[model samples]
Target chain A: MKRLIFCLAVLVLALAARPAPLFAQAGGPLRLEITEGVIEPMPIAVAPFLSGTANAGELAARISAVVVADLAGSGLFRAIPAEAQIAQVTSFDAPVRFADWKAINAQALVTGTVERTGADRVAVSFRLFDVFAGAPLGDGMRFEASEASWRRLAHKVADTVYQRLTGEPGYFDSRIAFVSETGPKNARRKRLALMDQDGANLRYLTGDMSIVLAPRFSPDGRQILYTSYESGLPRAYLLDLETLGQRPIDNQAGVATFAPRFSPDGLQVVYSLERGGNTDIHITSLVTGQTQRLTETPAIETAPDFSPDGRQIVFESDRSGTQQIYVMPAAGGPAQRISAGQGRYGTPVWSPRGDRIAFTKQQAGRFHIGVMRTDGTGERLLTASFLDEGPSWAPNGRLLIFTRVSQGEAGAPSLYTVDVTGRNLRAIATPDFASDPTWSPLLP
Target chain B: MPIRRSILTVAMLGLLAACGQNAPYGNTPPPGFGGGVPTDAVDVSVFGAGVTDTVLFPVDTWELTDAATATLTAQAAWFTRNPQATAVIEGHADERGTREYNIGLSARRANSVVEFLVLNGVAPSRLTTIPYGKDRPLEICSDEACYARNRRAVTVVAGSVDLGS
Candidate 1:
């Protein structure tokens, strides 16, 4: 009780210390309505959405919290606390009273209501309203789903608001599949992990039994392709997440495969094959398990990346006698060397825009983050560092997430992101070590 | 032209002899290259000036900058001066990229350097390349100042070269 009082006092003092109240007049739903078109972040309010007719078992609060959290976490909306909620909205179909919300300075409002459809099933509906504008931004959306899908409902609400306001797709509904790393640099322990975008509900897809690298999301969002060291041999495997099942993409030859990535259509898995001491890039059919050699001759052809339209692939090849990037048709043909003058370029990842390929280049002994158009032109190095590679795009294609390794007392890797403009560099928190990150498409 | 080439070759051989580990350094032997210099002593700290030259991209291209041709030209000259010193080009990426991609990129970087040297008259037999990516760093810190030092290709003489010793 004393602690509560002390915290309240501290908050009061701290808040008072500010030149003006950071949470003053415009911190409620009223501001949300008029502010929607203002281009600034619109303040909004989320009441614990009305619970379902079922038992709910604490999920009601959890679900409601998730919805608010998702919207707020995007650095977009300001979710006003329910503690100061002026009015209770019970029906998803009810007409909201804009005057009351606008008085609280909330320009927009998100109200959620759930109804039990079956024992484990429920119907969720959300209405986002612009208080000042006096109308819902989009048509009311309701979904018939399972209790576990409440999280998805949260994302949908955030997405709806995002689309309504920003005219861009929301990636809030996505998940990340990454190699969770532990141990030291020389002998590291790694596993495949899947987690919600906000780092919630983390689950290990692979046991820590063997080493794993580069877990990539399939187009369906229900599958992943990754390189595993099972059978004491490194190979690429396509895992059907729903079945908790696995299939080897290349088992007969049983060679070491590195840098496996999925085609944008999810029809193929392009990866590197190292057999009899020579490494090269290969493409395997997801359906037939049939494979085709993408590059031939001895030059360590590895790190294959595909353009978004699936017309061409940019990959690393030592064919010219050194490691540089070459662009080749997806149908398999002669490659034209694009990276002619760089020190060395590798890990060429084609952007979803189909215009640029992100790569790491080394020169004068330093590695840099660079990108170039599909024709191997307009190469611009974004960031310079000790080590930076693996540029995976943000769903909007505006940003990329890659790993940065800082060696000192701590010798390990961490995840980082940079605006494609090469500004606003920031780090994302990952438990333990993280690497080979492929961002999922915007969550439905 | 032939006399000049022969004289140049002989002078290079003499320079290797002066450096001590030259004969075994070049196409002479592989097993002899490793044992002498403590591989651990290979400094991961010194990457060249922050700018890397590539053949495809122009400058600062993590895409293997255009100057790569010229840098390799210079690196090839170094190899020419010390013929016996067979080199392993160690490629590294700065800390701004994904680790896996950087690793691959570094490998590509090192290979580009080796290729440039070979194309410019350095024997292909004299060069080996490996990409540490960002996994192994030359600089010890995470910031750009330190990162500039880490993104690099180190030409490690598989065998010790006599640095005029």
Candidate 2:
């Protein structure tokens, strides 16, 4: 029996080392497995965090609400309403009443506490329990941050709970950079904007003086790369978030450059340059300012994305007389077409896990947001609409957000998110029309 | 001489079409034609009157059709008549395509017009190009007619042009 248990432990470790599949459905008392079919949301109870200090009651409640909202919004967990709880968590260290939670059909229970740790500083701690097993699922943890960042603390706590249950990293603590649009479709004004993943902390990084498109976050999330028409022509610009300063990525006269994305290392930028009406992909070193042409075909080549390991680049091209997806070495070489199905494809974005590529396809008078394996197999269309394009992946590679424009005169573009399995389709709330959403890496 | 005669014939047809329709291109009448005082600087209205200032393209293509070529031929003649004027060609695409790809396609459309004008003896130094993609559409409908009107290149005569020069 001891040898058998040792073998099982080794097998679990080996599976963990491999890139996790679509869902981690490990056998556990509180497992919420998601298969190809309908997923029954797991019932979980998020007890309001206890306030350690007299003045922390309201903040503590708000934090708990955010945690509950995050889990419920994911569609994998069904948060039991606070009113439905049989008992309240009044203390942080007290043992959970497993029988009461089990009676309410809550497979998992979450409890936490909030306290004013210092001047303008707050501390949050949380613990997760398997109600059926009558034991804590993971060790309790605490996080400290500025009091103004209470929502982030809540996300971090929820992320910890999610990781412990799902065996996957949570994307709650990430941010998104997108374009906020206003005015008439004929003369719309666009500005770059950033917000937390849940649409909180909305802030505009650029004024509406110039049209901005496709704001992409660097791997470090401290800087943004986007296309702007400020110079009487479309060009790519790099904006530093800390200083709110921007500089053109390439400003050569008579050349229109746009669609810029940073390499995984954030040390190089890959973008398209239009010279005399020809668009091709080019990469420039940030440190050396040296630019190299990655593609030299007469056909249009744009929207280049680097793999997570920065070994290969996947981009869209029209060399085959129709738009299609192609993958090539990062150092520049012959590319192999990876999209073989009917219709046209563009805006190909490689998945963060390096297993799939998300793209926009147009066929038979309709547009679709789809994904395929790097080898071009397993093609699945996640969305079909009058106009849907530009798929940006979450840091965990489990979800995608793209733009969906309605049809006709009153049509406007909006941001929508969907799980990789094409489930849990939800629209992200923005103050104005939004598009080209790029998710930032998980916050440091 | 044959090109001049054809230009005159098309100019007459354009005037008839402008008078018989309610702005078929969806463009508001130029200042001088709409009862507003015309500025001394060359504008699209005066330069395009009786000669269309825009050329339309087929879907997802920048190749100049025969009608588009004829329109450019007329535009080149206008430039010759107003040698001191400069123009900025604006390229646009329909709403059916992606934003960045449309930008590229429109740029090609603008370049095609610029190349046509240069070949017709217009000075290359007097022209510039701006690809608007689908950001600006004259028609708001989602039908093919609206899309056809949106996919175009327009020669917007700049205010800096000195007619007296």
Candidate 3:
């Protein structure tokens, strides 16, 4: 992973310097309560950012477009089209025409400007305004970075705006590591690929020499753990994104290993290892390279995920004669079954917030992507299709991405995201057939 | 390539058996009968064509069926006539299950075949197992007909075998 480490020095300007009582107000700061019921998306206007320098015009427009797309893509906010705007932001420090925005039913507004600061560096600033309150929601801030990394600056601005309104961290700045597939279903060619959350900056991490499945990002977003058939058998390998170097997690030959995940602390990895005919979950210490068997069972046990706090682990197993979700101590112990539904369950992933577990369920010949409380209560299915599996949580735990394969001979797998409330279902655009999407933590 | 070689070998074996005993070497060759030919560097096709190389399994099952056992019995007899042969058993599954779980399931199926072969007089050291799960399907359709064929274990000849008496 080429770290896009931008020098985003926060240059707080004197404008909007007053710490307005946004959150301390009687009605609370502008918040979008994401519930299970239907929600009318909050209408907001993102004015085209003004260009401080002649060379910054195009970059300013591109940056503001990303901000608008990010906000609208969440399905919680609706971007008021630029054609409907009655007032324009002519300068960086221009006053907002609150009456004009209110007439367009724009409850919130965002205005920003971009300027060239150096030969290769640019500065971007933005302010979020509460159109209804006739005040700026928070202090206006500016970010400076290399001109090549303007997209990250735009995402950062979107993140700030999202945080101020929804009271949750933004996921737009994250990357996804997934298995990109092509060819036919019988002889599919799969390679590891990476991209921005919105499908920008697409790049392949590995060639199609061998089949790779389920690329998982490390907690720090610097490395990945995935299963590959490069050794002519399924085995887990740790890949350093920066160096593009990789090594098998276990050197023992003849045993198959797959379905790997990183511990929340990034010090260990839990994966499935098959010896002879039985499969069991095992944890390996990254620092010591020592492996310990976590689940000693003749039954199939795989797809292990660590809770955010690293105190517990959620996985799927067939010990009950049918696949179901289970929870056990992170150090290994007898697991308690958590699924009691009428279908088979597998690929259980713990939410980033540590409150729920997302999984894939098969019932009545239909597959569903679902979530439940950590203890297996409050079960809710988020998606249904011919085949839905491999649910990965966003960094904020507000959404999930999974693979959905259509039925039949020509069935192809694609990536889809849905809110935890079972709303905002949308497809992620990839260059080719894709699956096994794992979201990275917010970029540094 | 192996299939073509096996067909030629069978044809030559039939000619030799007919020349010697006035009978053709049938699909199930008699145990310990090498047909009076040097067995050095015998191709894997003989085992595949004459004794069968693959066995089908029920959905989500590793236990061998009665038909699978009969096939393995013939397989063991063929191995007895060729002691130097080593085999790799590939276990597979249908596309109805998750990827990782199917891997484990297919491993069990492959191990089941290996254990049966060992129990029926084949040397345990002569066998290795790999579980492909749903990754390698023989059929692409989603119906039961295709799935039944996909759920199988194949005993592929891996190393050189000396069939010479």
Candidate achieving the largest TM-score: 2
Candidate 1 local lDDT, B1-165, one digit each (tens): 556545544554454444342222112222224444333322221113442222222222334455555656665665676676676565667655444445455655666677667777888777765544444444455456666656666665543343331
State the displacement of the C-alpha of residue A223, model 3, in Å, after optimal TM-score superposition: 0.2
Shift in Å, residue A241, candidate 2: 0.8
Model 1 chain B worst lDDT window (10 residues): B21-30
lDDT of 3 by residue, A302-375 (tens): 99999999989899999999999999999999899999889999999998888899999999999999999988
* Model 1: lDDT of residue A271: 88
**Candidate 3 CAPRI category:** acceptable
Write the residue-wise lDDT of candidate 1 on A176-234 in tens digits. Answer: 77888876543356789887776777788887656677778887788888877564345
- Regions of candidate 1 where Cα sits further than 4 Å from its true position: A1-42, A52-58, A81-91, A103-107, A231-233, A252-254, A318-325, A334-345, A353-356, A360-386, A396-399, A417-427, A442-444, B1-165
lDDT of 3 by residue, B47-161 (tens): 6456567889998898999999998998888888777667778888988988888999999999999999999899889998777778777778889999998898888663444
TM-scores for all candidates? 0.63, 0.89, 0.88
Number of the predicted model whose DockQ against the real structure is largest: 2
Q: Give the TM-score of candidate 3.
A: 0.88
**Which regions of candidate 3 are displaced past 4 Å?**
A1-26, B1-44, B48-50, B162-165
Alpha carbon RMSD to native, model 2 = 8.5
What pairs collide in candidate 2?
none
DockQ, Cα level, model 2 = 0.33
